[model samples]
Each structure stands twice: as structure tokens, then as C-alpha cells.
Target: MRRVALLAVAAPLLLVACSGDSDKGITVRAAQVATVSEIVDAPATVTARAMATVTSPADGRVASLLVKDGEGVNAGTVLAVVDSPSAQQRLAQARQAAAATSTGAVRIPRVNLAGTQAQTDGAAAAAFAQSQAAIAQIPDPAARARAQTQLAASRAQYAATQAQARDAVRQFDAGLAGLGTALRSLTAAQGVQAQAAVAAAQATVAALTLRSPIKGTVQLGGTSAGASGNLSDLLGSLPGGGAGAAGAAGAAGAAGGAGTPAPSAAGGAAGAATPSLITPGALVGQGTAVATIIDVSALGLQADVDETDILLVKPGVRAKVELDAVPGATYEAAVAAVDLSPTTSSRGGVSYHVRLTLGAGRDTAGAVVATPRPGMSAVAHLLVRTARDAVAVRASAVVRVGSRNAVWVVQGGTARQRYVTVGTQGEDLVAILAGVRAGERVVVTGAERVHAGQKL
Candidate 1:
């Protein structure tokens, strides 16, 4: 009775296993003889490739805030205006100095060097003629003596003339060199003054108009320390102080003062350059970073990659990114860079920030086609490993025994369990390093149900 009962249960189980159900398959073909691309998937992000910050390059009073936040701006657009009358005045003074130096009176000294040379030359000629006459009057016996004396006198006169001419020439050349030197010195001084004028003018211009250096979105920030008001007065006045003195009024005004604008171009602006995107009445100051203009044309996705998986990522490797906020949309990308250093977030968690560059794929029709903003979550699949023309089996077909993995091979109507050393694999296929060959049948569908020596 017990045997009959066992047979009854066994028969139904056998029939059920042999029936045409999904679990009935017990044969496996060779793992597809194609190259299997191994991939690693992780989260990623989209961000601008370049970002610019607009700040006060000078310190002065804010006369006008030309742009507001969230507004798009182009390069060289005036964003704000600062008052710098003092700088303008200084520039005007410098310009006046330069003009005076340029148009200054010229002085020329009178020196008759040519007349002096002519007088010396005539004296020398008369002296030569007298010496020659003396030589001709000498007798034949005293001719030698007369010739020698005349020669001496003639040489002396010639030497005096040469000396006079040399002195005149030297004086003339020296005067010319001195005049040139003086003119050059004046010119150089004027040039220095002109440069100062230009600098002052540039400073005034810069103070008058705040411009954007790049095309992007705007931002805002606080006022400068000097422009904030006197700290002592502020402290003394606190909420209330002196009656109605200018000091008291000035102190109160300073306390409630709208912060000063950036300095003249000569000096950097003390206030922030108004970003077209920012609203008015925003406080800003010198050395304060007010706005960031981001270039969003080429998008980049930043992702945190596990240290273990980072080895598989290389620059230029293909990747598929899926944003959590945008459903049914996937962006094709490539590994732009792999950050070797791990950074800790505010939460004290360490992560490697990997940057992925998006490919040239656009979705023009969808309602959500608008570009994704920063802080969006994304998943990235990176190719890690691949195998070609190698034996593979479904992950389900692999079984673990002790420390080794085993799979059941069906050959000649018998089921045999064989150990395999695995390599790379995918969702449904595992690369077989040993114990299996291409085109050989293995249990794929009923991997969990099959055992060694089990009847077919």
C-alpha cells in the first residue's frame, strides 16, 4: 500500500514534468556563437560643461542694477552702472597733465658755431700765408732754419684752428644730443601721464557700466566692507544715537545704506555685477561672488561609480544613461573622464564622481523634451567585459557546488553534472571557461529541477 501510494505521487510528478509547459524543456544548445558584450550599469547625471561667475571687479556706489536674475545675457552686455565721479575727476586731471606735457613751450638756445668756425678758418689761412712768406724770404743757407720755423708756426696755427673747429663741432653735437634727450624725457613723462589718464578713464567707464564677460544666466550676492559703513559709527548708533548731526545722519544713512557699486575701472567694482537673471535691490560688494553664468549647450552627466567598477570604465567607452525624472527616455553617452580621487559629500559619504559626455541625440517631439536640470538622477550602463565565440550558458543553468560552479550536461539520454570555470557573462548568458563546448546540449530550462543521473 505504501509503494502504491509513492507510485501514485511519482507518476503525477513525472507526467507534470514531461508535459508541454515552460518547465518541461531539458535540452540546451551551444551558447550563442557570438561576441557577448559585458556591461556595468550605475547612476549618472547631466551638467553644464562650463560655468562662469560674475563678480565686482571694482568698488563704488551702485547707481543702477541693469539686469535681473534668470535673464539670459550676452557677452559685453551692460548689467549695472556704478557712480565713480571721483575716478572721472582723476581721469580728467591726468588727461590735462598729458595735454600740457604734449603742448608745452619749446626753448632753443642761440650758438653761432658756424660763425666761430669761419673766423677760426680765416685766421688760420692768414697765419699760413705769413708763414709761407717768411719761408720764401729765407736765403739758401738759412732756408732750412726758415722752413723749420715756418713749418712750426703753420703747424701751431693749424692746430689752433683744428682745436677751435673740434670744440665747435663737439658743442653742437652735445647740444643736439642734450636737446634730443630732453625731448625724449618730456615725451616719456607725457606718455606716463597719458597712460595714467587712460587708466583713470577706463576705471570710470568700468564703474559706470557693469558688463558680462560671457553669455549665460545671472546670479547675485552682498555689499563690500568699506561701503557697508563705518563700523564704529554703526556700533555707536546701533538702533538710535546722536540727534541730527551729519555724522549721525550719515551714520544712520550708512547703516541703512544701499551697498556701494564696484569701483571705477581703475579700481574693481565693490558691488556685484548685476546678472540679468537677478532681481533688483539685491545686496552685493567688492570681492563677493554674485552670479554664475552656466553654458548648457553641451551637457555632461556626472555619476558616482563604485571603486570596484571604476576599473572597467575608460574614457571613450560607450555608455547608456537613463534619467529618473524622464521616463522612457535614454541618452547615449560616453565616458568623458574617470575621477581617480574619491570625494566626500556633506553627508560624509565617499564617492567617485565620474563625468559622462552625452552624444548628439535629441528628442524634439516629446512633451518632456526640455533639457533636464542639474541634480537629476540617472543610471549608466558601461561595458565592462566581452567574449566572442566562447561557450556560454544561462545564469540559471549554473549551479554552485562547494566552492566550484557546476552545470548539468545532457548527452546520449543521460544527465551529467560537470564543473565549469566561468569568465565574463550577461543577463542570460555566462561565459564558460571549461567543461562545456559550443553546440553541446545542456539543461537550460529546468536547471533547478534537474539532478545528476535523473531520468529523462
Candidate 2:
């Protein structure tokens, strides 16, 4: 019984020894398992896709550029009109001349050179008659012999007459060929002139009526429409016309193939009330652009980065964009292009333009919900680091001395200082290269105070 009592007492003491120290100020928690990521931030700017300089076609006064910059336009829509009274008058005259000279108006067919050939034949005949008359004279005993000689001469003259007739026939043939060619050429020229006159008249009339060549928001400028206001509002409120309808349809159709038809005209108009091509009374000039209509159905982002960061960007690289205007929202984008040439800021600094195409991701959906503006500031994070299941520890927990990294690890009721190789680091963690293993206890607390083989 005494031996059993001694055994019981020894078991308690052994349990205490195995349990080590009691709970104290130091608290231990499991290291968080997470994938580490890093980002490089660069400043950027946004710009329009294209900018055009509108000019006038003819030398005329600034009759006015009806639309202001940033206005929308449509194809075949008249943007501006240049007042050219002289040009209009000239066109009218040309039209009249063309109508007079057109087919069925006045066409003349002259006799072919065959008639000229007939006159040459008559001349040849007269010369032959004179030769015969001369040969008939001359008769003496010596004259009689001479008369016989004269008769021979007349016969030779008759042969020459036959040769002349053949020459006349050849000349007539050539003259007829030339006449045919000339007639055809003249007819073609007259036809061209007639068509040109008609075209000139039509073009002159067209110049007077400036219409929208593209469907877009119109800005009143060069010439005012008697009222001044935001260009976008005016375009939205303008009446319907063929030009306007086409523009609206095009814009809506481009917004993803689902679009509503523009409102139709109600009152007196032929076939269909064509929407007004442009706002009525809007002033325009020769070749002056009146509107800048953009199809915002799909939107993308453009960024200007420093030359140093350009190399890191490539087409298809994944990126996240946070717009300054859209707080707490990020848009998913992909690298579309890396432009080597300078895109923005003409100043002495080196910069390149990078285009980011927004993708149909959650971030992009957020952008649509937030509706970021065109020029809004955005920060992009290009994913460059990728690693999986790497062992890591807080960088702060590992103290670097010279070329070696040291961390205190707990073992056998004591703290041990271990020198380790760190492969990578993060804001809160460092990858332990060779000195640590998963699920091992480390001195996260009291790390700075612990010494090698020190008792806890």
C-alpha cells in the first residue's frame, strides 16, 4: 500500500513536468493562411479616342461653324454651310447650259468627209478634161504625126484619171473613219458636260442646307441658333428629321443591338416624317463640324504611364482599376495595348500610353452601376506576382542582422534563436526559406526579448 501511494505521488509530478510552464502574459495564435499579393502603382491620365480639326472647303467668310466642339454628328448629315452666292449662281447657269446640251436637247450630225471626197473627184475630172482638149489640137503633115502623138497623150491622160478616181476612193474611206471617231468623241464630251452641270447644281443646292452627316449631340457655335445652352440638352430636345433619326438609331443600335426606335413625326410629311438632320436654325460653315456624337454603349479606359513602367504592361495582362470618381469601386480591365510613342503631356518627361479594355467582370459591373466619368482619375493594379502555398512569416517577426534573418522558435519549454533564409516578404509576412516547418510552434510574442535556449 505504501508503494502504491508513492507511485500515485510520482504520476502527478510526472504530469506536471510534461505540461511545462503555466499560462502567462504570452498569447499564441495560429498563423493566418493566405495568398500574398503586391502591386506597383503608377500615375495615369485619360484622353479622347480621336480629335479632328474641322476646316472649310472653299475660300469664304466664317459664315459660321454651327456646331461647337464635342458635338455629335451622323454620316451624310450636313455639318456646316458656307454662303457662296456667286457659287450658287454659277451652278444655276451650268445647270441651264447642261439642260440645253443634254441628250435629246440639241444633237447635230454633220455629213461625213465622203462629201469632201466627192469635191476632190470633180477637181480631178476637170484636170483630165483639160489634158484631153490640149491633146486634140496639133495637126500638120508633121502636124498629122503630131496629132497621132497627141491622141496617145490623151489616152495616157485617161489612165491617169482612173488612178485619180482610186486615190479619191481611198481618201473618202480615211475621211469617213476620222469623221466617225470625231463624232463619237464630241458626243462623249457633251454627255460629260451635261452630267457635270446637273451635279454642280445639285451640289450647290446641297451646300445651302447643312445637315448632320453623323448622328450625335450638336453644339451650336460658329453661328448661333439665337439661343445658347448646353449642347447635349439641345440635341436631346431637337425635333426629329431623317438625319436625326438615323443618328439616334445608329447610336442606340451600337449600344449592344438592343435599342428603341426614335420617335416618329406626326404631322404633314411625305412617306415618313424624316427626323430633322440637324437642329433647325443652327448655324454652320463650310466643312465646320457641328457635333461630336460618341457611341458610349461600350466604354474603355486609357492610361498614360511613365516610360519605366511601360515594359511591365502587356496585352492580356489582368488589371484592376479604381476610379477616383467612383469611390470604393474597382473595374476589371485587361491590358489592350502598350503604345511606345508619347500619348499625352508634351512636356519634357517620358511617358507612354496604355489602353485598358474593361471586361465583363464584377468590377466592370460595379463601374456600370457607379457610372464613372470619362476623365475620372483611376488607379490600376497590374498583377505581377504569383505564388502558391508558400511558407511565410511576418517580416517584423524575423530580425535581419547583416545577411542573415533570425527568428525565435519555442522548443522543450525554452526559446531557441534560429537563423533562416527568407525567400519573399509581404506587408505582414515573409517566406521562411529553410528554417521553419508547417504546424510548428514559433515565438510570435516575446520574440525580441527571447534568447537562444532561454527558459520561458
Candidate 3:
């Protein structure tokens, strides 16, 4: 009887020890109402609002390097001058063509028809007869009538020519050697072509004198628009008509594409050569980079958000930015745009470009931060999802119960599985919508070790 009684007391003590040990291995927290946010991180780059690139309009040698690199310039300011022999030659050719075609008035000599009038009249009659026969063959009555009228007019013109010739011969017979008949003047099309060629040539020469298209600092290199091919401009400079060549490649996207219409500051330059290379007499091709003007009045950012998180991001979404150069500073920004086109990330993951307008920022000391220059690297944490004052639990507490999410709640020393409708998920907290309640204790640290009705 004494042995059995000692066993009974020991069993209760062992049960208390087991419960204490189980509780020691797990951590539980009372659920409370809190704000939960889902942040999507993205890689970003700073860029300028606009950039202007000045290019060599023609293949030529750098005649004069006007402004130094890094010098601020105004729009229309002459940055450099290129001496293109080809452009000068084209101008000269255009000028000479214009001079030759100065007057579109043309005259054909009228031969004396004193002895030839009879022959000319006979030939005219024969031609009219033959033409009339052909006109008769036209089945359409309206067409035949039109042809007959045209044939009669032609015959009348021939007779007029004979009369003019006869008159000229009489004048010659009267001893007036300079008296002769004049034919109709030529077309004015030649004149128009001449003017067009001259204007185009002049424009081409003017382009060689590179001017700043925008007010910005002059970089060593620039970008250009693609091949300039104008049919009228081309035809105007022919032996009598064709004139100048086309200009190619527009200034593109980082500062410079496939990249962006407004490039990042680092991307716009094709290549920057040393100041010496661009000195007088250096040769460059048509559309070659001569200089780039960066407009940094407004700053923006481009970030590549992963495809998985892109759906959560939209215009006007709030974000916080951090730059490597401006350490300890947090920049406030909002999504200005989200690109429809996707770009492949370095890890081969699909991502999209998201643009944001950087707003005011503060350093750790709470002072207003200065604007970051273009081409700076940055990271943005986008507040894509948020839940305000919702019942929430530690993220570790929520466990995947197959298709649904659930949390282990401690009730009267027993753990119970409460299936939840999860909402906004933050880094460390998860919003529980349906199953979980505020003030309820949930197993957080060791949720995986808990079973239904498990003692805590």
C-alpha cells in the first residue's frame, strides 16, 4: 500500500515537470491590433529629367573645340565647330547648280519654213489622218471625241509653228539677221529644285557648327538622331537634282534604350575621350558624339522590381530610398510610373522598371538632404500593401496548413489550430483577418512543434 501511494504522488509531480518543460521550449504572445505593411524592395538608379546630346552633323574634322568639358552652357550656345570638306563641297555644288538653273526660261530656234512649209503641212495632214483612224478605234464615244479634239489642237499648233517659221524667213529675207521666232519657256520645276538644294546645303553647313540644344554642363560626348533621309532634299542635289546625305541614331537611354527615352546620367554618353582627342583637327563621323548636355533641374529614379512583386506596386505608392553615396539618409519618394515592358535581372529573373519622383529627404540628424546627382545607385523599399489597426500576430506564428494559413493559439493550457484569413504581411508581423482574435495567446517561436490540443 505504501509503494502504490508513492507511485501516485510521483506521477503527478512528473506531469507538472513535463508541462513546465514543454512551456519552456515554446514562446507565446498575446495577439494585438497593429498596422502591418508589405514592403517590396527594388534596385534603383537616379536619372535627370532631360538630357540633350550634340552630334557632328557630318563626317568632318573638329575645327574648333569651343567650350571645355564640364563648362555650363546655355541653349543655342556654340559648343564646337566641325570643318567638313564634304559639306563645303556639297554647298559649292548646290550653289553652282542653282546658278545654272537661275532662269527657267528656255528658247528653241525657229527654222525658216519658206521652202519647208509645204512639206511640213503635208506631214501634219498625214499625221492627223493616222491619229483620226486610231481615235475611231476607241470604242468609248466620249474617249474618241476627246482624242479627236486633242488631235485637232496638235495640228493647229503645228500650223502655228509653220507660220512663225515663215515669218522668220521673211524677216531674214528682209535682211534682219537677228529676227527669229521664240518657243514657249521651260518649266519652273528646275528653279524650285535649285532653291531646295541651296537651302539644304546651307542647313547642312550650319549643323557642322555644333550648338547646345539645352542649358546644361557639356560632357565630352553626345548622341544623335538616326539617318536623315529626305527625298526632296536628296532629289534637289542630283546632277541637276540630288543634294545632301542623311543623318543617323538618335541620342538614347542610362544617361543615354531599350534603356529609356530619358536616360540615366551615366548612360547618355557614347564614349568620353580625353580633352586632347577632341582638339582642333580631330576627325569624327556623321552623327558621332561631340558633346552631351545633362539637365539635372529635376531628379528621378528607375528601379527594377521583381515580377512577383510588380503586381503589388502601382503609381502613387509610397517608398523609401537609400543611396550608397548618401549614407544614413532616407529619401521619400512616390511611384511616378510603372513600366509595362519587362527587363531581365542579373539573376535571370523577370523584372519591371518602376520610376519614382524623389522628394525631400533627411539624414540621421533630421536635416533636409541635398538632391543626389544622376547615375547614383539606390534601393527602394516600396510600401505596396498595408493594413491599419488589424488583429495581427508574429509572422513566425502563422503556419501554412496546406492551402490555408493557420496559427497555434494557447487556450486554457491547450494549443488549438485557428485557421486564418491572412491579409497584409510585414517583415515580422502577419495580419489575421477571420480566425484569430485580439488578446489571444499564440505560439510564436515554436509553432511547428505544437499539435491540436497540445499542452503548453
Structural similarity to truth (TM-score) of each candidate = 0.49, 0.41, 0.63
lDDT of the candidates, in the order given: 0.51, 0.43, 0.61
User: How high a TM-score does candidate 1 get?
Assistant: 0.49
Distance (Å) between predicted and true CA of 203, model 3? 3.4
What's the candidate order when arranged by decreasing TM-score? 3, 1, 2
Question: Which 10 successive residues of model 1 have the least lDDT summed?
Answer: 1-10
What lDDT score is found at residue 52 in candidate 1? 49
Per-structure clash totals for the candidates: 40, 35, 26
Candidate closest to the true structure, highest TM-score: 3
Cα RMSD of all models vs. native, in order, equals 25.5, 27.3, 19.1
Residue-wise C-alpha lDDT for candidate 3, range 1-456, written one tens digit per residue: 000000111112222211223445787777767767778888888877667655565566788998987898887788788786766666666566556546534223345434444544453454345334434332222333554565555555555655665565566667764443322211122333333344444555655666775667777654324222333432332222223332100000000000012223422223223343455776665555667678776678888888888888999999889999898999998998898989899789999988898887799999988788777788998888777777777788899989988898889999999889988777677778889877778888788787898787
> Which stretches of model 1 miss by more than 4 angstroms?
1-30, 55-61, 66-78, 81-215, 219-281, 285-289, 344-351, 362-369, 388-390, 401-404, 445-452
Off by over 4 Å in 3: 1-25, 94-202, 222-276, 368-370
The Cα error of candidate 1 at residue 144, in Å, is 89
Question: Which residue window of length 10 is worst by lDDT in model 3?
Answer: 249-258
Cα-based lDDT at residue 92, candidate 1? 54
lDDT per residue (tens digit) for residues 135-238 in model 1 = 33221213224344535653554455456445545655666443444333333333332433333233333434556656666554322322233335323432
Which is the better candidate, 1 or 3, if ranked by TM-score? 3
The whole-model C-alpha lDDT of candidate 2 against the native structure comes to 0.43
Deviation in Å, model 2, residue 188 alpha carbon: 31
